[model samples]
Target: MKPATAAKKLGIYLPAAPQDFQDSEVTRAEFNQLQQNPPEWLAELRRNGPHPRPVVAQKLGISISGLARGGVTEPLTTADITTLLAEPPKWLVAERSTHAAVRKQDLIAKKLHSESPKN
Candidate 1:
């Protein structure tokens, strides 16, 4: 599979992966092995990685746009994400509230849509 696809499956950030991993292609066997029984390196990467934006947002409990607004342009390691969550800044706090509001609105909208008559 492609590097990006592999990284996504592994829940890792491609740019932060090792050089060899970045350069090589992941065969089906390798992918399956990684899923079934990841090696030490793979385990380490998943545990403390430069996680992708979606994962980062999920970990931070904010939207991806929130990360952008908070000026987090680069991928963050698990440690960095942990620290941010542990000590949320003003922007993060504000964004989390905004995100929560947006999610609530979305839920309301979905309910309204479901209740509406079919056209």
Candidate 2:
């Protein structure tokens, strides 16, 4: 098999497909929350202030103990959520990965079509 055919057989592609920005939009509230509010692990690293967990619990009208036990790590404060809305982070590499996966599927389909004999 030629290099291209061999590579295709191995599910590899050169010059990967362009990333899709629209599909990469951050719609998950929890993920957005975690990115906006510094995680407890990160806050401790920066030493900027205490973990915002207590403050978030108070704002949400939930007991800190309840929030913690509920495993709701990285709960977002109102301001954090607002800021996230104002300016969200770009998941460039993630989008690229998704695009590549979709393109690979398309390539595989094309290869299969070419291989199949038609009546």
The numbered model that scores best in lDDT is: 1
> Which stretches of candidate 1 lie above 4 Å from their native place?
none
How many clashes in each structure? 0, 0
Question: What is the Å distance of residue 108 in model 2 from its true position?
Answer: 0.5
Q: Which lDDT tens digits does candidate 1 get at residues 37-85?
A: 9888878888898788988999898999999999999999999988998
**TM-score for candidate 1, residues paired by index:** 0.87
Candidate 2 lDDT over 5-68, as tens digits, reads: 3222322221221133112433356334634684554344223222255554444444555455
lDDT of each: 0.90, 0.44
Model 1: which residue pairs collide? none
Index of the highest-TM-score prediction: 1
- Compared with the true structure, the alpha-carbon lDDT of candidate 2 equals 0.44
> At residue 73, what lDDT does model 1 achieve?
92
